[model samples]
Target: MIQEMAETLDDSGSAAPRLKQTKQNRQSQILAELNRSPSLRIADLAARLDVSTETIRRDLDELTEQGLLNRTYGGAVRPLSTEPSISERHHLLVAERERIGRAALPIIKGGRIIMIGSGSTTTHVARRIAVELRDITVITHSFGVATVLAMNPTIKVLMLPGEYHATEGANVGVHAVSFLAGFHADFAILGASGLTVDGPNEALIECGAVYSAMTMRAAETVIVADHSKFDRTFPSRYAGWQQVHHLVTDKAPSDALRAGLDANGVGLHLA
Candidate 1:
């Protein structure tokens, strides 16, 4: 009888720790999903995690108290001030970026020079270009983009000179912009932090200058951005809608943004 009582006590003690561990794991998962997607609805998260909406709400509450995320009306969003590093963004929205990359491929032609800007989405485009196209030259200030295209022996990569931004994994400075001015490209494939009615925006001023230079030197400008960027505005407006030739994205733009694109004659390619 004593043994049975002791065993029951032991089981109860272990159960508490196990429950705590499970909660911690669930919270970790919530953060990971938010990293992949900037915002998450409670119902969607609860459904995906196989938990009750109440439980998800509690987790969100704890995370918000810790300042990890901001709780919204019925969901949570990543902190707006915290921009994910390029490496982190590379893992986020993989499928959507891949679709955008592939859709932008038609803009590339053989024996032509293209300038690719730095961003997770642009890196995807570089990967597609390296595998599918040959006998072309790529001019880029992004170390990541240059590295991807270098794998294709037939494709020549020209690296621009500038100060390197470690987090962005790209070169940005007066030198990079000046170097771009010396040469023109058939297409400038770029990425933006946001895409609103005003235009494509960049978070970094130096990067914005590089993009602007590329657009000016290219025959046509292709902006590759995911749905997360739609209807959003950033600090620096790199180019006006009239300067952008094509926008390759995973979803349709908002009504106002679409009107702006139409007015400026920007081609919308939905991936």
Candidate 2:
């Protein structure tokens, strides 16, 4: 009986396929999917990875055990509780920024006072505003954005003064927020470090406070971000979904975020 069982096991092709699903290979694939979507269904993972649903479920279970993901009813989701570093986020979605900025252009009317927060994506929005709109006043903490807008003859620039961060090339401090607090804008175009179930978030506490104040002071608050920011959390919480009037992001809004915004009665504009 032992000899016959050994022969059958050896002849079975299933052992080879099971052995092929190594821990390293599974983790890599899971990370790739997690990077693309904040949450994924088991069936979706099976389709994407070309593995059985059971294999994907096992992989997700292992990832959850490692604290890399949180396994839920149907599948798994990227952990929202963890905050990623700002340096880790530089230049992640450049193409998405351009797309988001282009989508935001028509919404920005000419000759209005606009408050732009500093970030790669928001800076791109400033560029679009400078090129498309005339007779506009731009208030920003971004030195780079100010320099670009200054080249346009019709656009007026108002730069808030504060301690400069060499990495971000933007000002952040009490001084910057104080300067912004005094002005009321037609629309505030802000960049977000992350977005969570709670709201739009920022990495720096001071920047979050300033961004929140700016949103409050503006008639409308429009958040411009790439898809990467969605469903992610930051160290600091700024404004909730209700505080935002509109969201401009690259590609269509995911069903999860869209549902959240819809529930809050906020509009979403996909670039």
Candidate 3:
């Protein structure tokens, strides 16, 4: 009787882990299916995973709470592509952004003016620049970028004049674009909401205009983005692939995006 009780306890302990793994695997399968298409129905997932509809619904609810996907009426869809506010995005993909930021440092030459656009990834680049580079002038409309660079006494921060966007913590308007046009820079380091085969894009048209001006005014344009931005397209196509000179990212572009970058002679640097 004692031996049988011990054996039963061991089996229960091991079965708990097996059940946990099964649930995790099921959720992963749900995400994978959603990635393949746009949305996933609970009935389809249940049939495919060989689980009950209730199990799929519970999994979807848990995934939604974790912000991995959005739960719909009878299914789930990929997280909305709409750009999140800077405050929200700044906390997402932090490690990847830091790596991408560090990778961008080599492209900057000392004693040259660089134009930076406003975004979470670009703010990471600014932080790296503050610590790594010196005696460089940074032209930007981003309050966050300027504040980061201000810590380094050697770097000069130029704040552009425009309408201040509180959520983005950046300035954007005709004034900012016109001010940027008046001066040229050695390099332009900008971030993107999404990057696709067509090119890098911004969520806001005002910010896109500022990025567009920076790309044209600089000799070489470097786009800093993470894997999350890959294969995603936004409303504003700030610069075409031909205008972008280098892409500093944590992951390599997809096949279609790579072909576009190659056709345009854009260099890719993976962190």
Candidate 4:
């Protein structure tokens, strides 16, 4: 293909000089955007670049694979750092996470007994549920989620007893997992460090077991993450693509992920 393209050009000729220039310009603009803002939201980038969010995700993936950028749960950042922990993630993409939370609201209709895992995004869901719904029994390992839902007197919040991890603001230990094994929850609403076609992933090994236990007890499982988590991966994978029944995100996933979800019969909900 390279030889054919070169033969089609004169000493300094090409079929699509303008096209090459355009691609180069787009990539350059992306670099500029990242340099200016260490962490750039994929949706915001798409809007600024006048393209779809999926396009931005694709571009970011290519760049990250080439060591040009880093991927986050809801955006991209410089390659120097890993995805921010849940403690630091609340401020990164608050609006987008809130939107995802809202999108996940209606999914709780049939279930008053739900288990919410720990994360900034899941905290948003707990917030929405605290106000939007009533008279529910909520179980969780996340202190943050428990605190938020506690405000609603009508809702019964059960805290799983275990060792508290301050950074994740959640409990993760054998006790918690054992406690969760006692009930078949109506739904398991969870957040992840990253997500891929393979499954939902977690950053810390400690939480992976707890999350896996939660999913096992729940009648249904839903993963709530943003588009930035699409191609991102983490060390601990708790649930497989087949285990997730629903996915809520701020933007559409890439073609491959969507196809995988479809093949696995995973419902996709974009906020």
- Worst lDDT window (10 residues) for model 1? 1-10
lDDT of 2 at 255: 76
Residue pairs clashing, model 1: none
Q: Report, for all candidates in order, the number of backbone clashes.
A: 0, 0, 0, 0
Where does candidate 4 stray beyond 4 Å? 1-38, 42-75, 78-81
Could you estimate the TM-score for every candidate? 0.78, 0.71, 0.74, 0.76
Q: For candidate 2, lDDT tens digit of each residue in 148-228?
A: 787789888888889887666778888988887788999999888777667889866777877887898899999988766
lDDT, each prediction: 0.87, 0.76, 0.85, 0.83
Local accuracy of candidate 3 as per-residue lDDT tens digits, 1-271: 0111112235446522122226777788788887665556788898887789999999999998998886654677677564568887786668889999999998875438999999999999999999988888999999999999999999889999999998899999999999987899999999987788889998788999999999999999999988767776678999999999999998777788899999999999999
TM-score winner between 3 and 4, please give it: 4
Candidate 4 residue 116 C-alpha distance from true site, Å: 0.3
Q: List the residue pairs that clash in candidate 3.
A: none
- Which is the winner by lDDT between candidate 1 and candidate 4? 1
Off by over 4 Å in 2: 1-22, 25-90
Candidate 2 residue pairs in clash (backbone atoms < 3 Å): none
lDDT, candidate 3, at 204: 86
Ranking by TM-score: 1, 4, 3, 2
Better of 2 and 3 by TM-score: 3
What are the per-residue Cα lDDT tens digits for candidate 4 across 1-271?
0111222444666554222224456667898887665578788887887778887788888887899888775577766435555666776678889999999999987898999999889999999999988988999999889998988999999899999888888899999999987878899999987777888898777788888998999989999987667776778899998999999998888887888899999999989
